[model samples]
Target: MFVENLGIVLALTGAVLSALLAGIGSAIGVSRAGKAAAGVCTDQPEQFAKVLILQLLPGTQGIYGLLVAFIALSRIGLLGGGEIAALTISEGILYLLACLPMAFVGYFSAVAQGNTSVASMAIVVKQPTQAGKAMIFPAMVETYAILALLISILVVNAI
Candidate 1:
């Protein structure tokens, strides 16, 4: 009965979830890091540059999510090619499943990265000279997001 519509539903669901979850994570993560940055900046105005960079670290997840959503939408003909209604149930489901890893991982990693950045901000607060080293901690969390992005892109392209 709903089979004809299921394809578009699944495809749209995947695209929406990928962007929505990742954006939420980035928003929360950036907010937390921004609060930490504000606290640090209030104490030491000179640390603003370092803290700002750290605070922005989690934003990459949102960009990754957007990329995946764009690719998925394009591949499934929602953004280009034919009409979105032309997608098959199997193809839509495949796209949906392919997006799950990035959606889940991106959300969790961004939040974790934000927390890590906040902790790293403490390091920057005390040891200003070690800001470069401190940045590495939060940067490490980005690995998983990038991996997830890569996998999602590959899967979307493969489909």
Candidate 2:
């Protein structure tokens, strides 16, 4: 039974890591940005809406991670109450590998975006007119998360 279920275990590990690591990264990023935003808001409450947007930017990676995990789980018959599809070890490894890009990239990108977001908040502090441009900086970091999402989706679906 252990041998039979090893594939499921491996695949589940991938899903868990994707969700857990990305979620953790987002949590850290949001906390850091939120702290900076609160400091800014202490003097300028009017900036809450703008800073909120920037603070939330790092969170999308967690959502993307969840999306990929959902896709993987649904495909593996682990969602919707279906019996888990019996996967060979090689196929399970593929699932693990597929998830790694999102897991690793999402984690790093979110942290990077958070740091960028904090800096962007500084722009809001001095020149509120450039809030749009401030947002663009963090959004740039999102591109890599999107790329990882695409790769995970394609690879998991391909499997």
Candidate 3:
């Protein structure tokens, strides 16, 4: 059965990794940003909303990871109970390879965005009036996450 069902197993592995790796990254990223926000809010409680928004920026990758995993799972019949035979070993490897981009990129981008968010929070501390401008710095890091999400989605769907 292992040989016969290898494809479905691999496909499921991909789906799980997409969610797992990205979620881990987001957790770390959010934790970093949250710690920074908490430090800033100690003195400037009024800036809660601004810092909260900034802290959430890195979290999109986790959500995107879930989306891609769901799509891949659904495509591979894990969601609808379609059929294991529909996917060959080659297709399973393809699915696994396709998911790698989201898994790795999401992980790195989230950590980077989190660090960026922390730095951005410093702007909130110094120039409350420029809080809006401060967001731009972390927001820029989101582009890579978006690109990874789009590519993963496109490739998983195509496969």
Candidate 4:
């Protein structure tokens, strides 16, 4: 019983932590992108479409985290079960460790992507067609987040 409860606790903790990390990352990224967009709009108000896309780039991480959490929850049977057993200490520890990389990577990647988007936005204002090219940086950062998420999921499943 205790072991099941521990599993539930660890899983919930991991889900919440992952969500928080992704949410915070998106928030920061959006904020940075918003600021940049505002700056661009001041000079070129017509580039709204381009700027909006740039601003939205950083928001994807939050969705990724949410998906991961949902996957984890489903895997652990937390949603349907009335009570769960606690995990073994080793399992709990493993779960925690697995969650860390995604949280950290998602956070910093979003921030970095935000910065990249800001720079890209500036470029887009000058050359609208180049916007796609500008997205490469954020896409690159997203790869790391994806990798982290995959690792976390694999680890969780293994436990």
- lDDT of each structure? 0.91, 0.92, 0.90, 0.79
lDDT of 4 by residue, 65-137 (tens): 7766776666666666755545666666666677777777778888888988998886788887787887776
Q: Which stretches of candidate 3 lie over 4 Å from their true place?
A: 81-85
Candidate whose lDDT is highest: 2
| Backbone atom clashes (below 3 Å) for every candidate | 0, 0, 0, 12
Q: Report the error of model 4 at residue 127, Å.
A: 2.1
Please give the distance, in angstroms, between residue 49's alpha carbon in candidate 4 and its true position after superposition: 1.5
TM values, all candidates: 0.95, 0.98, 0.96, 0.86
lDDT of 1 by residue, 19-65 (tens): 98998999989999999999999989999999999999999999999
lDDT tens per residue, model 2, 1-159: 988888877888888888988888898899999999999999999999999999999999999989888988888889999788998888888889999999999999999999999999999999999999999999999999999999999999999
The better candidate by lDDT, 3 or 4, is 3
Better-scoring candidate (lDDT), 1 or 4: 1
The prediction achieving the highest TM-score against the true structure is: 2
Q: Please give the RMSD of candidate 3 to the true structure.
A: 1.1
TM-score of 1: 0.95
